[model samples]
Target chain A: MSLELIKDILLATVPLLVIFPSLFAFTTWMERKALARIQNRIGPNKIGIPCTRIGLFGLGQPAADGIKMIFKEDIVPRGADKLFHLLAPILALIPAMLILCFLPLEFPWGKFMSGQVQAFLLDSAVIFFFAISGLATLAIFMAGWASRNKYSLLGGMRAVAQMVSYEIPLVLSAVVVVMMAGSLNAKEIADVQTGFNWFVLTPWGLAAFIVFFVAALAETNRSPFDLPEAESEIIAGYFTEYSGFKFALFFLGEYIAMFAISGLAVTLFLGAGDGPFLAVAPWLSVVWFIAKIFGLIAVMIWLRGTLPRLRVDQLMAFAWKFLLPLSIFNILLAGMSHHVTVAYPGTTAQVVTWTVSLVGMYVMAKGLDKISRSTAKPREYLYAE
Target chain B: MSILGGGIFKGMAVTLRNFVGSYFSKERFITTNEYSWRPESELPQSIGDYPKEEGEQLSDTTTVNHYSRNFPMLLHDTGEPMDTIRCVACQICERECPPQCIYIEKSTEKKENADGKPQFYPAKFDIDVSVCMSCQICVEVCPFDAIVMNSQFELSTPDRFGGLLVRRDDLLKSNDYYHKIHPQEAATRDERMAADKAAKEAKKKAAAEKAKAAAEAKAAAAEAANESKEDTE
Candidate 1:
């Protein structure tokens, strides 16, 4: 019985560990190539198949980078807290990897199991995912404080502030889904939206999804919201003192967190593995889940390439004044929409609810934008003509 | 007044267009493809085969246009570079160069140039291209029409100190080569040099004729005076 329990646990957790890190490697390559194309430059086309001149469109670049990162000298500052500095990357990575199991991705191997096998099948799995992912902020702060560098400290503080500020909208937006599904269980939430009824299809769901995505971007420290590790401002933020494999760990942690958050986004709104051919071939759901995650990741990469980083003030204002109020209003709208759907269950009722919710969300968003906008006064030049 | 965050979508659309357009339109996007590596056959052997058109996209290291000027090269008329070298070793370019990258050692004995005029050749002419700013200052200061900018920019070498110091022989490119690289500029330069040469020859010829006429008149006057003296005696 004990051995079987261990086996089931391994079966549930092993694939995630094997798959996501490898996906992180591929994502780095894809991001470089995509960003290069966007800027009209060829990126990493030279390095390819080893021991030969034949370039395989630079696919082997990630492996080469990994080797380089491993072989690099690990540097530590004299005044640094050596133990915490060493522990920080590991700490940052743990929460990110821990949250991956809660994504509600059902594999074909689950059928062979004697009992239902999941990494952590909790009643409040979504809340647990949020609670664990929030620990990544502590890791950032630890890295910053341990480094004994002012820039690193500032980066740590900014990350703490940004992640904390954005977490409100991030959780609140997911709350709409949780409320709709009538459970905080990720699997149940996903199961409720089984057939073309993705939460994002509805008006409030769309608003909630938008808010969630924007806040997710902040949560992952992805650009426009990537002010924490802002290279120009903070010199790589908390990991400024880290070098070699430690630095690589931080990078891996960050990308893995991206995958984790994107996966959650898919689970919450994109109908988690629910696709057209699910009835014909049940196992294709895994592919559908991963594809949806990749879709979100692709959009994230596209946004990173498209948008510039927001200023400190703008980032705070965006999260607090804009996303905070908007998400709260969306929750109320979602509640009203839910009651309306229950009271009048017909096509005409559905149409009316959709229109009213859409219009209401739009008006609220416009009002929030107007309120949050800071009026800039024209500059008066005294010396210059 | 405007829709909120509409600018982000518009910007995303522009990037999307660029990302997709790069694959189809090689000329409009991904221009580095034109000048990167290519097969040996397409690569230029001499300056004649080099691309001279204003915006002609080629697939070789020699993918340079007419207006793209780099470091200075000495222009020779024809035949061997040393035999027909245009530089008189005047050191004008060497003295006038902003960075003083040019180093010239004047020959002890004079050698006849392409025009059959005796001129001091540069025995040891070297230009440290590493120090050259590519400002075309040496070309501007050169009165002999010897120095002109070469369009070849792929000057990377393993031997930093020795390889970058371009010797006199390496610097000497044929006039035909210059004409191939920069047709319009070379044409105008050649025209001006020809006109100057012609004007000098014309001035010399007129001076000789006037001197001969004056000598003849002086001889006549002297002869007339001698005959009159004989008659008086």
Candidate 2:
């Protein structure tokens, strides 16, 4: 029984450990190349296949970077809390790696197991995912406090504030999906979003998805919401004191978190693994699922290249004033639409709900924008004219 | 009415156009290619296979436009660069140089210029390129129309102090090279110089004719006076 348990554990974890990190490496290269292209410059076209004249468009760059990062000198400040400082990157990396298992990605290899197996199949998987992911904030705070640097501490503080503020809307927006799906199980959530019944197609679903995506961007410390590690304001935020492999760990953790969040977004909406030709080929579902995640990642990259980082005030205002209330309103709309659909169960109900929610969300969004704008007073300097 | 998040979408569209157009329209999107390597032509496939010789690398890589200017070089008309050199060791350019990078030592003896005028030449001309600001003041203040900006910018070398101080022999470049590098500016300068020379020659010829006419009239008057004296006698 213990052997079987060990076998099950290996089956569940080994693939995730192998797949996601490699994906992280590839994503780094892709982000660099894509950003370079957007800026009208060629990036990293020097390093190619080793010991050969043929250039594979600098594909070997990430490997070279990894090797360099590994061999770099690891420095620890004399005044730093050596234990916590060392513990911080591992802490940051754990939750991100841990959360990847919660994604309902079924593999063809699962057939070899005696029964279907997942890493952690809790009844409240979505809640568990959120609960674990929140630990990343503690890691950030620990890293900041342990670093003994003002900028690192400030970054940690900013990260905590931003992540805490944005988490509300992120969870609230996912609530729309949980409400509609009638289950907290990630597998069930994904299963419910089959065929053309994607939650994003509905009005409340669309509103919640937008809110959720924006909140996710903030949660991941992505640009336009990247105040925690604002290079101009704070030197690399919580990881200011980190170097070498520890720094690489933090970097890996951040990108993996991005993947995990984007994965969650795909499962929540976009009909996870629901694409054409699934009947003839069952394995295509995995491809569809990963493809959807990539689609969201591509959008994130595009947005990162397009938008500038928001100021602290602007970031706070956006989360509290705009996304929070909008998501709350969406929950109400979603509940109403759900009941109406159940009672009538026809084209009429869907049509009415779609129109009312669309118009209602638009008006609410505009009203929120006006209210926020009206209330914002110009900064009053104490000493300056 | 203006849409709320429309600005973001517009910005995204602009970036998307740039990202896509970079692959198709090299001239319009990819501006750095002109400064860097070209994949199709002389660029080696691998970094390890890059040209080893400095001259080969520079010749293969550096392609500055005609308008691009660097440090000043002395222009000579033809034949030996030192013999036909236009610089007369004039201190005007040296004085006018903002950074005082140009150093000139006038030759004790004089040489005949292209115009057959005895003029002092720069015996030990040197320019510290490291100190040069490339302000073109030296080119502007050169009364002989000798110093003009060179387009060769790949001047990096390991021997710092000695390498950067360009000597007279290295500074002297033929007028044909000047024309090749900057055809328009050289042509315009040549035309202006030619016009000035023609005007000077014309003025000189006119003065000679006037002097001859004065001398002939004086002789005629003398003869006439002599004849009158003889008639009186």
Off by over 4 Å in 1: A115-117, A374-385, B29-233
For candidate 2, write residues B56-174 as lDDT tens digits. 42241353556768778888988877778899997888887768998999999999987678899999999998999999988877778999998776676666898789898888878
Candidate 2: list runs displaced more than 4 Å: A378-385, B29-31, B34-233
What's candidate 2's DockQ score?
0.41
Q: Model 1 reproduces what portion of true contacts?
A: 0.62
Task: Write out the backbone clash pairs for model 1.
Answer: none
Kindly list the per-residue Cα lDDT of model 1 for residues A305-370, writing each as its tens digit.
899999898899888888999999999999998898899999888899899999999999998888
lDDT of 2 at A266: 89
Clashes of 2: 0
TM-score of each: 0.71, 0.71
Find the 10 residues in a row with the least total lDDT in model 1 chain A: A376-385
